[model samples]
Target: MTPGRPDPARRRWRRIAVVTAVVLALAGANGPWLYRFGSEKYHAYRIDRPEYKARNGRWEIVEFPEGYRQNTIHAALLRTGKVLLVAGSGNDQENFDARRFDTRVWDPVKGTVKKVPTPSDLFCTGHTQLADGNLLIAGGTQRYEKLKGDVTKAGGLMVVHNENPDKPMTIEAGTRFTGRKNGKTFVAQDAVLVPRARKRFDPETGRFLGNDAGLSRVYVEAERRGARHETGAEDNYRVQGLRGADARNTYGIAQKLALDKKDFQGIRDAYEFDPVAERYVKVDPMKEARWYPTLTTLSDGKVLSVSGLDEVGQLVPGKNEVYDPATRSWEYTGKERQFPTYPALFLTQSGKVFYSGSNAGYGPADKGRDPGVWDVRTNEFTKVPGMSDPDRLETSGTVLLPPAQDEKYLVIGGGGVGESRASTRRTRLVDLRAKNPRFTDGPSLGRGTRYPQSSILPDDTVLVSGGSEDYRGRSGSDILEARLYDPDRNSFRRVADPLVGRNYHAGSLLLPDGRVMFFGSDPLFADPANSRPGVFEQRIEVYTPPYLYRGGRPVVEGGPGTLRRGGTAVFRSPDAARLETARLIRPSASTHVTDVDQRSIALGLERTAGGVEVTVPKNRNLVQPGWYMLFLTDRDGVPSTARWVRVP
Candidate 1:
């Protein structure tokens, strides 16, 4: 134009240019919205539904031919195609002490259950498959006690007097009352006052002592330190006579004494069950007694036993032991390698152990709860970041998805600590192959769950079933709907729901015939309320995936029952031309949402005249010495029944 003004012809051109500029700006601002609309419309017909294929698997309730003797607390798929079920009193302390038959052999093919005598109570024990196809079970509960009685009556309380004395201090039982003595903090354990003897009896130790003695003695030291005031005889008389009306004076009294030895004792017995001989042979016990421990098979074939309560029912966070199958004995690995009780530890391809952050019951809430890469050799733990809802993963299921070469780890549903009314539906995945491994959000389940079962299917998919939506299946939190997780798509599809609601103590395993069996569910921990009086879950159900219904399953005519490392396996299958994938899945020994020694490795497949030849990798880390289920899938992803193959 002319500096600030334009001529008539030039003004028209200027106006047109400004209008075009404005239009372009507006279009740029709305570009993403327009593009999204157009892209969605274009792909509307192509958007595929979440695959449930194999023809949509179905679940059927199957009754145990001669129902289980006890609730199924532990289950393992034997190399012989039968299942080994162990209950060990099934959380029934009375029955357990009475020597009830707690072990059984479940023959799925014959629909029969055979009882096996167990030497000790295997309740709350940990187990993993050894290289010889035998199960090494270790660390079980000597005894357990449910919380009972009034909060104040069992454990004495402590009251703090401050400027606001009228507020009335509310001291709860189990709350640690600490005092300062010699510049050190002293903690007072629970105690009950014996007014007649002018002393307190340590019920936990079954010993009567002075009111200010033993654990509670710290309170006396604290009184000298002026940390708090301990009311004397006059106050006790007024409080005890008023029927606890003046709780303030009694607030300093210790109610519940120490726990009894029988309540927290950990068993030292360790045994290896020979599935073929159907007998349990006692092995060298652990260096430290453990209850509720986790037995993990290391990449080098040695079993790592970590976490658990010690001889006295106390969480042993830093005391870990390694079991050498060669020596058939356990060696203490020191406290540095200690982890949370029942941590779901996965064997990485690099020979490192990955803690999946899924713990069963007991441990330090802060230390061993984080997911990390643990070097057993160096005792180094590298925490993996980016896990969602890590705090509430108690009893959650975790697994290294199929094609172990991918190096991906996944953790599914779990609940909060103790009796907290919280559960989670969150799932996370981490790629161990990454330079700095971190978790990423994965698929969520249909509902929040605790103690869910995740089983690796023959078709490289994971079937997740059972678990409660709340803590201990309260308020009808028992979930029955099952789901299938497809790693290829990173999505979850709803599968058929089972008839019984499995929660707390439930287990599942992949059957050799491409089916999945789900059993055991003790929601109340053997203390079923009057509303649901019967406690134990004695029923078993088998899930038949859609692949089974698909007509003409590729027949695995024959294959070597045993294989060698770095060996080639020639499988006789008439549908070799149609075969698309070959996979080897380790037999699962699953319990308490912990599936020990379960892994899937994809075998390199090559078509032959009438069968397929598969090359097994030589890496022992990828294919540890153990029994595996070899399966063949057709081009349609329909898998054939697995054939048991041992790599020894």
Candidate 2:
């Protein structure tokens, strides 16, 4: 419109152009920040949408108050609907030395946390849900491990022998043993009770046989810390403070005592955590100390404790025992069946223990690695075959599928034994009902995973989530993925991604409210480079599945607190007409990705006028005597808030 610069229109047009250019320049300088802000806003809006939640579910982080947070290495869902978070020394040597054991009871619904006074370091202990709704907790940290370079004292196992056949004797703690050949002295760290020598007799003719010395194992460390104090060969040690008959009756024998890497040691402490009282009730300690053991409830309501590092920081060597709730005592099984630490052993419908060959760690790779069905009474082990990636079973997650009658199990992803980098994406399914129960390849994960946590939902679906592609999340390999596995279809549906990365020391629990709670992740490193040490994940994450976002759930108003086996228990529910399935899911007592306590049992549901009558399974093995969350699901697959029920 303007040709000459003197024209007013031309000048006005030039000024407008300059203003536009300046505005564009300013926007370019702040473009990245503005884009990020807009993108975050859109993401928040999209995830919160009702339809999005209905399709993908939702995840929310729960951060505790500063004072209550802890490194939760073990978690159990109590009958009171609260979670027991146990840290013990929390893998912290300083805390162990300071005796700062920790335990917390967290009410998920009320959002309240209460601290409990822990009796000992229950780190790496074994736990199972008892018949009377108490958690039978056994074993713990006797001593922390020392690496090769970190070890300053020479210590090892010392077998004390008793030649006297008359009476048993106790070698008190602080008793010194002098090496007869090496002239070195070592002190016992704990008391050893040597039983009376057994007078053997020939069963055929009742002839007297030579007396066998009673033996007991005890750990001893050198009097002082030095390489010179280490023993290179087997040596006989004289019992100090003993004279004449006592000295001749008792002696000590040891192999090599060196400054080698010492493993984590265990204790014999046992407790029954009362959910009502919210405290630990000390019971008779186990005869043998165990760390990283697996406590499985037998068909007779006895808890079978098996496989762990003993007080001497060595494998327990098949010394299995059972805890009888009636006597509140532990008795040796009188049978020898060895397993690796935290072996995935589940009680089958046939009243036998089914070992999945999935273990945490610590055992000879060649020994006790086969999956089998073990008869505790008969000591029979029938090996199950056809396992894929058998070497990678360590750290794998084994879950018994819903409807306990099916006797089907899915063993998900695992890694190589003991910090090995090898991992597998394959999942193995075994149906024990089949005449030949063998592990068959099931659905595979997107990538290799270890320490994956799987929880059985009331809707008969399983939520498999979290794990790392590497050992202990090395090199920041924690997978932030979640999937809902449909047992009917035998396929996995990818859901919303988890905001947190979880690997070793992580587990999941199905809450009574139909949501799932995830806790604890002890990654080896925080950064991808793994140059820095990882911090334990203390903040909990609760997941609301897509089924919850669909519609109003069936509400279980009133129900009988106790249901006898083979008996029907009527529960008042206005939506009984809509109820199609009932499930009794045992609350999870999970640690190290090993949860033998969780099993979903299908209940017989008969719709009544104002309620539903549910029948319990008669088989004790199928329906373990314990507290379970009774959930009623409508035709829409929406499950009601669980009603606490005890199956007697």
Candidate 3:
């Protein structure tokens, strides 16, 4: 070949080399795409590939058949396989009064919602499951306030105490006053309460009551003092005798006015809901009226109530009490254990309660916000150290990690205290079995969230879903994506996202079939008008994890309907040889990121002739007395539909 040009044979070789180099470069550019396609189409079909099998789980959402009349502020899984949804006033006082259905029993199988009467406003309350399989719902709002303009027009006459006589006893237009007549209370839309000063009248000693008799005397005295003539009144003081009774006893003007008109107050009402009877039986009320108290069932079946706003709407002091089912009354524990409102407490195997460092909004941040183990017997608190971002975990989701044998707890995302509007993405786990028992970092969520729901799965994985990045779930803050946390790997994998966005007042619970139901979102704090469509989330959605899609679910054919603690039970399963594990999950009473009674117990399984012999733990702490869903999973991690078994 020439220096600058090549002969035919040499030129052919040069062209081949250039083509070869171009082909190599193109392959490198598209290599990842080709590998991905091959892995998905071919390698994924290889059942033995662990990596492919790990990616099999997905999320499925199903809408409810009907929506709730009121916003669902609280939700729980009842023992009858029904869902109990409670929403007192549902944030809309007017609408709630119109409909008057604050509580409902939703049967998922029947696709129906039955309204149940609620004695008090359960707008913001706490609840837990009792050992006798009853739901103990405690505390709630006594009433809700409405603006004068929002209420009907019915004004009461008031004696004007015009300190300045020069100014006419002029009632400003649009001034509001409440009046009572003929056993009915009315609001005065055009006048305010103004009483004139009297030489003999000691306002302090008057003890001005809210009744008509008391108000009529003031009107008569004002008339005697020529108050009507001075004002040139067209309408006489039409103060009919006060017919209504005052809810409170007080002397001050503000106090008297509050008594005259209804006002919101926290209540001491406590009751047990019987799912079978579909009714609420009155229980002994708490010693102090509570608005947002947490009720945790002890291992012995007694319930301990802690932290809430009192009847006067003030935070109750650290004093706590335990409820005895035998007596059907609450006995002051004599221990003043103060915890934040709706503190997430878990009963340990030793009967001690573990404050999971998670609390519902409302309490001194320092008092009960610290993660600790509280001994009810000794009234001693052992604080767990090393928890990051502990102060602002309000509305955060928490769970006693599965395989109850492992005493580990995980606290998920939450928001800051007192309208801080800041959400957290940090997660932490504390192993109670550890010697020091300090919280350590777990996997962090991709984004900060508040009000996330953590559901423990039969396969020992935790599914976290639904929360907002902001306090009240402002737009763009709704966390729609769901994730699964695998304990074996200590990692989170993104799953399917629920179409609806949930925030404050949202709730979730695992069902018997291993699916999780997400319901009850009150983003606008129950204001239906300001809430955008779908924000209140009256409709329910069921999330089916990917494991359900895999074929060949283990079949649990026969098992004892009732098993005693530390008892031996034989379960017949078609795939006994392939059965890898069995679990007993307590039905949860969950609301406000607080699941007081839910737990998972891993059963010891031994392959029998045609089935498996499962040994239930004798430890009441591990498996408390209640109804639990028993599930068996195969080697592929596919769990059978759970069977409800009562542990007496």
**TM-score for each candidate, following the candidate numbering:** 0.75, 0.96, 0.74
Better of 1 and 2 by lDDT: 2
Q: Taking the candidates one at a time, how many backbone clashes does each contain?
A: 14, 0, 16
- Model 3, range 491-579, lDDT digits (tens) per residue? 89887667688887778899988888887776754343435533466767787777776777888887779988777899887799999
How does model 3 score by TM-score?
0.74
Q: Which stretches of candidate 2 lie over 4 Å from their true place?
A: 1-36, 202-208
lDDT of 2 at 350: 92
Candidate 2 residue lDDT tens string, 203-311: 9999999889999989999999999999999999999999998899999999999999999999999999999999999999999999999999999999999999999
lDDT of 3 at 170: 36
lDDT of 1 by residue, 173-250 (tens): 233433222122223332223221135578799686644321111121121323233322222111222224333333
Q: lDDT winner among the candidates?
A: 2
Where does candidate 1 stray beyond 4 Å? 1-54, 65-67, 146-264, 525-534
The alpha-carbon lDDT assigned to residue 334 of candidate 3 equals 88
Top candidate when judged by TM-score against the true structure: 2
Show the lowest summed lDDT stretch of 10 residues, model 2: 1-10
> Which pairs in model 2 have colliding backbones?
none
The lDDT-based order of candidates, best leading, equals 2, 1, 3
In candidate 3, position 215 carries an lDDT of 18
Better of 2 and 3 by TM-score: 2
